[model samples]
Target: MTCSIFFSTELPNDRPQVSGALPRAPQRWTMEWCVKTPDGRTHINNSRTIQRATVAEVNAIMATTINGIKAEIGDLATFISGRLTSHGGTRKNRKGGKRR
Candidate 1:
């Protein structure tokens, strides 16, 4: 399943009615993300929220999350590259020509 994450500038008006853990620590704002699967169904059946005191902190968290995702994609690319090259396979360019 392919999944993507995005930060919304506006809160969803028709959010699903679900309760989550309240922020226990000192925090002024909460950032939320909804994970949806194919057919437009929520993956977790609920929105995930994280509490942070400042927008910078939330942005930092988002950056870290994005970086982690990039790392995972890199690993997957490496694995696929190894597999493709394992059986004497050659890399192909967009024009279907062998890549140097």
Candidate 2:
């Protein structure tokens, strides 16, 4: 049983979608902090220095994300319903590359 066999989910092959959150608060460093070396590799710290989060706490935080998105538009239900086929994730910092 290899990784490719164990954790493979398929999506429809199509053009990628682009999206942006209009009125969103800046994402900042919370309990989950990571360090990215200059070489472009990302490291998630899992040490005593970090406080552990409970499942409930994490879910609560994630719920706020939807609230933030709704607040960004005049009518979230309408906006989302209209762009059901489009709206993707945040596009900021999309220049995913090693800046040497």
Best by lDDT: 1
Q: Which residue pairs clash within candidate 1?
A: none
Candidate 1 local Cα displacement, residue 10, angstroms: 19
| Residue 67, model 2, lDDT | 49
Deviation from truth (RMSD, Å), model 1: 21.1
RMSD for each model, in Å, please?
A: 21.1, 19.2
Q: Which lDDT tens digits does candidate 1 get at residues 1-100?
A: 1112234223366222323333334344333433333344432212223433333454466556535544744533211100000011233556856556
Query: What TM-score number comes out for model 1?
Result: 0.29
lDDT of 2 by residue, 1-100 (tens): 0000000012235222324332232222132223334455544422111333433343355345434444643222321211111112345565766455
Count residue pairs with overlapping backbones in model 1.
0
Assess the local accuracy of residue 12 in candidate 1 as a C-alpha lDDT between 0 and 100: 63
Worst 10 residues of 1 by lDDT: 78-87
